[model samples]
Target: MVDSTQRIRVGIGGWTFEPWRDNFFPAGLPHTQELHFASRAVTAIEVNGTYYSTQSPKSFARWRDETPDDFVFSLKANRFATNRRVLAEAGDSIQRFVESGLSELGQKLGPLVWQFAPTKQFDPVDFGAFLELLPKAVDGLALRHVLDVRHASFMVPAYLALARRYGCATVFADSDKFPSFADVTGDFVYARLMQSQPDCATGYEAETLARWADVARDWARGATPAGAPLVEPAHDSGAARDVFVYFINGAKERAPAAAQALIARLRTG
Candidate 1:
């Protein structure tokens, strides 16, 4: 069980575009090398590639070895499980994807993020059923399930309640299309700041990072500000109460700079 009242774990998205590669890692470094470099600064990573395809066991084994033991990898469940038009029909596919990853990632598996497409609307019955099925799917594995629903219709109080009931973390995405942190729910928070405009997206302003850091710190200590709902107790201690903030707003050239800045802020404070 994760201790919520402890230091917050900060990290960036796993895939970095070409332009920002040089700044974060030496030019022409291999993908694994880049991952190692990022791990040195940040303790967690959002594995975006799993959304496209399942990784082979051999590949996953190599990834586990490349990073330090304290590092955590948050995997995005494959698209077939998340982007489906018919939710119930995805059971087999979802099971297969989860099983494949679990075989390789073992204990290194962090949270399994299910990011539903924006076009999909919320169907309470279907969504609830889906959430109920998840715990059984990853039965023995010790990992957290995170929901990143993007539609405006899905941001209601009922939806958040369902997320908490199933013990899944609701992602707090800072995007124009989705609701912000004020309304999200969960014991563990996953924040992804996807950039829309060139100015705010390319790199985080000093104030922006500082503001987020403060929130992350407060959440870690189990002290929600007035009006914020108290987070449910998920673990014996609060050490695992992590704040995963990724900067997806930066241009390909600026992601490393933005990630580095955030990492520095978390460490210094």
Candidate 2:
């Protein structure tokens, strides 16, 4: 999806799901070709593997070469960086994660998502320090960060203000288990929709997919989607902003289908 200035991207969490080998990936498609095929199918993909372990610079370069020119990958930061009891002391871990060859992805890198556990409450001071530790750039390439805060305590004006101050995006998680809300706090919008169903052929019906397409468009134009749950007052800067919508944490098997369906709707408009 596009306007003259900004872009709207749709994707799934990762490319190597075994179920997708039969469901999303073509029959007999080589496992090694999954990224090649997936990169073509969706405009973006969240690199979930980065959350578990650090990848080599060669691996990042290979991923960059595997995808299309316009494709982008949003990486989930290492669990050790964000899953700590003390956020202020995570500077070293944060540095390690950013220094772990992410710059090799170059233009193909989208955003680095620092996801926190549900148990981590909103300690304004601690959270602020964590956000501060995120470097603005690495190896001359600009870095974009997205905070994935799951605790309900983060649903406050202070949290939004902090995020806006640092210009980091906050996740708009669409999950029943998390505090799912939409608040625009940065230069881009990052959403993780997690309600896809295994029964629906396309994960979501035409109506839902169409609605998401509309929401994504609104975000691209720098408007918060009307009727979206927001913790802070909606502000329209009227500046074009890139939007990333990933079908993540749902019935994982249907994420690819959901992403493809949303992409189809986005393309038609």
Candidate 1 collision pairs? 3-237, 3-238, 3-239, 3-240, 4-238, 4-239, 5-238, 195-249, 201-249
Query: What is the per-residue lDDT of model 2 for residues 109-194, given as tens digits with 9 covering 90 to 100?
Result: 99999999999999999999888898999999999999999999999999999999999999998889999878888999999998
lDDT (Cα, tens digit) per residue for candidate 1, span 105-202:
66677788998998989898888878866854454666678888878777566777888788888887666656555443556777776762345542
Off by over 4 Å in 1: 1-6, 136-139, 196-202, 225-240, 250-252
Q: What is the C-alpha local distance difference test score of candidate 1?
A: 0.70
CA lDDT of every candidate = 0.70, 0.90
TM-score of each: 0.85, 0.97
Clashing pairs in 2: none
Error of 2 at 133 (Å): 0.9
Model 1 scores worst on lDDT over the 10 consecutive residues at: 229-238
Best-fitting candidate, measured by TM-score? Answer: 2
